[model samples]
Target: MRPRLLLVTDLGYPAAGRTYRDEDIDLAARLRADFAVAMCHPLDAAPLMAGFDLVLVRNSGPVLHYAEQYAEFRRVALESGTRVFSQLSGRADMAGKQYLLDLTAAGYPVIPTVDRVEDVGSLPDVPEYVVKPKLGADSVGLRFVPRAELGAVTGQLIQPRVPFRYEVSFYFVDHTFQYALHAPDPGRRWDLVPYEPTAADLAFAQRFVDWNTVDHGIQRVDACRTEDGDLLLVELEDLNPFLSLDRVPPGTRDAFVAALTAALLRMLA
Candidate 1:
């Protein structure tokens, strides 16, 4: 019998820089070929997940939008032993931005990040500092403040506003990189183009993937190149990262789907 997959998504979410609905629609259609897939909002998952063999959370949007309900869902899933892809064990987005500070202190190649107001002086002297909530995503509640005004932005973390050359994202399925994409123009983030990653680039991205240590599910290692031409970690998305399959070549997209399908099958086994 085909495995029953409950794909959780927020079809009506109005994301500022990207469209969540279109990605989920295309992904669900593709998964239907192998599994009996059904789509639902994140809110519905807690009630419906027990009936499915696997619950695939893709592009569910920031859980901050529904914190109480999200906690309830997590509790229920864990209690029931439901198979959650990218599993609820994720320490990145699932846990919050504390990992950024942890990685920075640990001497990882991530952008220097600090959560306290006093530590603002520790970061480089950029004209402005990027401040965002420790639990935010998709630029929600993110703000830029002048160096002088950092004193007023209480209860927020800060990072130097880097003059990054460009942003590149590496996609993975179960610790294996499937493909890469980059936004050539820093101003246009969602306008991604196919990126060919060198062995060194793969090594850089793999460091975080290895650290994440998820036995299964998808992840995207987001990074930016500095003015001196080095990649620094921007964000590690282990939750529902939107796969920009639309931007990749058709063959590449097919290869990614095949890889993901194989991973899911292995996960089920």
Candidate 2:
């Protein structure tokens, strides 16, 4: 008998220029070849999860919108010892934005981040600072404040507003690099195209992937190329990061699906 798989996602999520429904629909169709697949919203995951052998979270939308329910889901999953892909132990975005401050303090190539007002001096003296909630996602509660007004800010992470040339995201399935995509125009972040990464770019992205140390599930390393020709971490999306599979070439998309299928099989093993 095929193992039962519960795929969790929010199909109706109104992503700016992308469709979560189509992507998950395509993904589920592909996965059905290997497992008895069922789909559910993040809200329904906990109740439905026990009936399945594994729960794969994808495009579930920002947990902030359903904080209590998400927390409960996590708690139940952990307490029940139910297997979760990307495993619940991810220290990056899956946890929160705190990894920004940690990575910055550890001197990783991430945008300088400071959670406390007293630490503003640690960042570059940019005219404005980007502030957002630690638990926020999809830019919710994100704002920019002038350098002069930064001292008055509270209860959020802060970083210099980096003026970058472009944003690139490296997608990985279970620690292996799959492919990359980039937004040539910073103003339209979702307008992504295939990006060919140089060796150094792969190394830079791989460093974070190694740091994350998740042995299963998918991850996207989002970084921005600065004017000085350096890449800095923008986000490490380990929790339900959108694959943007529609943007990649057909061959690349096939390889990605193959990789994900193998990873899921390994987890089930």
lDDT of 1: 0.90
lDDT per residue (tens digit) for residues 158-252 in model 1? 99999988999999999999999999999888889999999999999999999985878899999999999999999999988989888888898
lDDT of 2 at 166: 97
Q: Lowest summed-lDDT stretch of 10 residues in model 2?
A: 209-218
Q: Measured by C-alpha RMSD in angstroms, how accurate is candidate 1?
A: 1.0
Residues 33-106, model 2: lDDT tens digits:
89899999999999889998999999999999999999999999999999898788899988999999999989
Tell me the spans in candidate 2 whose CA falls farther than 4 Å from its real position.
none
Q: lDDT score, residue 118, model 1?
A: 89
Alpha carbon lDDT of residue 227, candidate 2? 95
TM-score of each: 0.97, 0.98
Clashing pairs in model 1, backbone N/Cα/C closer than 3 A: none
lDDT score, candidate 1, position 238? 93
